[model samples]
Target chain A: MTTTPAADTAVTAAALALGDDALVLSHRLGEWAGHAPVLEEEVALANIALDLLGQARVLLSMAGDEDELAFLREERAFRNLQLVEQPNGDFAHTIARQLYFSVYQHLLHDRLASGDGPFAPLAGKAVKEAAYHRDHAEQWTLRLGDGTDESHARMQAAVDALWRYTGEMFQPVEGIDGVDWPGLESTWRDIVEDVLGRATLTLPEGPRTGAWRAGAGRQGLHTEPFGRMLAEMQHLHRSHPGATW
Target chain B: MVTTTPLEEQLLELAGSVPDPELPVLTLRELGVVRAVRAHGTDSVEVDLTPTYTGCPAVEVMSLDIERVLREHGVREVTVRRVLAPAWSTDDITDEGRRKLREFGIAPPRTGAASGPVRVALGPTRTREGGPADEPEPVRCPHCGSPETELLSRFSSTACKALRRCLACREPFDHFKEL
Candidate 1:
């Protein structure tokens, strides 16, 4: 089957977008290695981070190779959605971010698995893992949401703060042309609503089409925060090119 | 006819005996990681293994172990390959291996279930009481004969198992998911 040049470019961009999301989030989650709220949760978050990193490695490697895709790409060339690139605010905010992104990822992966594209198989493999990520986030969300008043308040504030970023998850980028956008959007709405119901959190309703606080991360245009993130992520690799541990 | 060289037989025996580094009771044969073994034209032996989990640290140790065992059997040049497709599952754990894991104090995962099938079902099976849709069959705690177990953590020592503590025996055991 011959893919038109446009289609090929689009597919490549879509894969990069997906891969970048996993890579950035995996790196962010890795920061919680020994800094989690509890011991059991530290292990759990680490495991989840590793899983995301594993997925990122495969997806990024598939996008190109290990070195080229990871080390070679410039900050402006990245296409991950902004939500993933957002700083892990606090314990409550991190869990809140996990809940939002994992829910989106689970739904996105589930739908993409059935799509008629090269990404289908990758999505199929990743969806199972992402499902667990969503479960982990959901469990934490419930515990935090239903726990003490302080915990509930913190979690609620987190959810509210992160809600603005959720819009971009469903927004279709130019590179992902020919995707089943309607179906994906519907699935995202349904899953997000269900999870929000369980967490006893209200969905923040607003004008869906409004100026984003953070500009486009999907268009290879990222916030200044991404530049700082890249500096730290690439420091060692750039310093010692072709060096291996 | 001279019996097949003791070297060949010994290598085969060593290959057969090397247990999976993750699930130590299960031989790589039972785990289905050992794909093939062949004498590499004379002085060398080639062995292939697939990783049970992506980026599993144990795969490196298992590869080294294979080389050590084969060297002991007077063979050199062991090759281990990481095959990604047809991913490993708890279902691959043989019945005999399951028994061995139980004896070793680490509970073998239940055959056929993925990491947390019951918990995965919890969302769709949400009722007034928050039970599963179709009541999940009792998961026997491999530590004791008790069905009174609670899921303590989903992430265990490995991704394949969940940490469950038995209420009856007060022991934490790995419930191999019924893959």
Candidate 2:
């Protein structure tokens, strides 16, 4: 198609926002490499991480150099959702994060895939992979939420703790054309509520709206844990600049 | 439409003949990743390769292998461009590729399933066929050809396959999951 400088800048901003989300979450999931509770779970998490990493590479490349965008960017420059940068506290917490983010991502990509835009091609491909990731989270949520007193308690607590971060996901991102943000948000709530109901867990009563919502990653603002995570992530690349296998 | 020259056709064949880095049993042609090959003046060529999964690590190796193979076949330069529009699907795998996958102890993905967003069905894996519009035929075990197979894990050793075990033979095998 045709584009002006303003449209190109908007596309770049949107690409960086989406790309940073994938890159940050991929690294967080990759941290579970040797620490997963089981072998199968470890493989599954890594596989999902790889998928996100692949998406990150494509999206970041659309904005600028993928490696530089990922490794050299300061903490205040990242545009990822704060929810994705949250540490993997426990198995239950990680699954909760996956459930919220994948549902939003899958739905968003599904909409983007149906559009004629810069992100449509990658969205068309990633939507399928996101379906699997969403399924994985949903299955785990059901098992843990309905399993036993302790598992159910942990799952409930995890979802509630992360509830505040849910609101930021529905915020409209620039250059992502042709999406019904409010409709998507309502649908997200319905899906999450159904899953939680089936899992025998109560929906978090935390405020997900209003001015106090936990977000601002899109504006290069992040939570306390993000700086440490970025330091650890960029160390290797910075130490050995221009290194290759 | 531009008709491919004989040299382009031959170069396409050479590029497509490269074996997949992950599944050596299938060539890139059989896998349906090598979309097309174009020749620019006899010495320079470009090949189109689509990834099975967005993050499939094999794509890099496949590109390198294709370049090496085409270059050795008398082309001075080779360029492999990754195409993502009309995203690659399991349905793209050739019938021969499916048969070879089954022969190699991996159940092939069911064809004819509509490509798009799929609902998450969480529960015990059943062996029912024609159950619903979304659910296609049951994945039969490649070893014993038993239909009583259950999904163990959605993500297996690779992104494109799922780990499943046959209830009859108690053998676990990877099934190329539908994208």
- Candidate 1's residue-wise lDDT over A20-106, tens digit each? 998889788877877888777777777777777766776676667867777778998888887888787789899888988887787
Candidates' C-alpha lDDT? 0.71, 0.91
Chain B TM-score for the candidates in order = 0.75, 0.92
Q: For residue A24, give model 1's deviation from the true position in Å.
A: 1.0
Runs with alpha carbons beyond 4 Å of true place in candidate 1:
A1-8, A173-179, A207-215, B1-18, B34-51, B59-81, B115-119, B122-133, B177-179
Give the CAPRI class of candidate 2.
medium
The candidate scoring highest on DockQ is 2
Best by lDDT: 2
lDDT agreement of model 2 with the native: 0.91
Model 2 sits at a Cα RMSD from the real structure of: 1.7
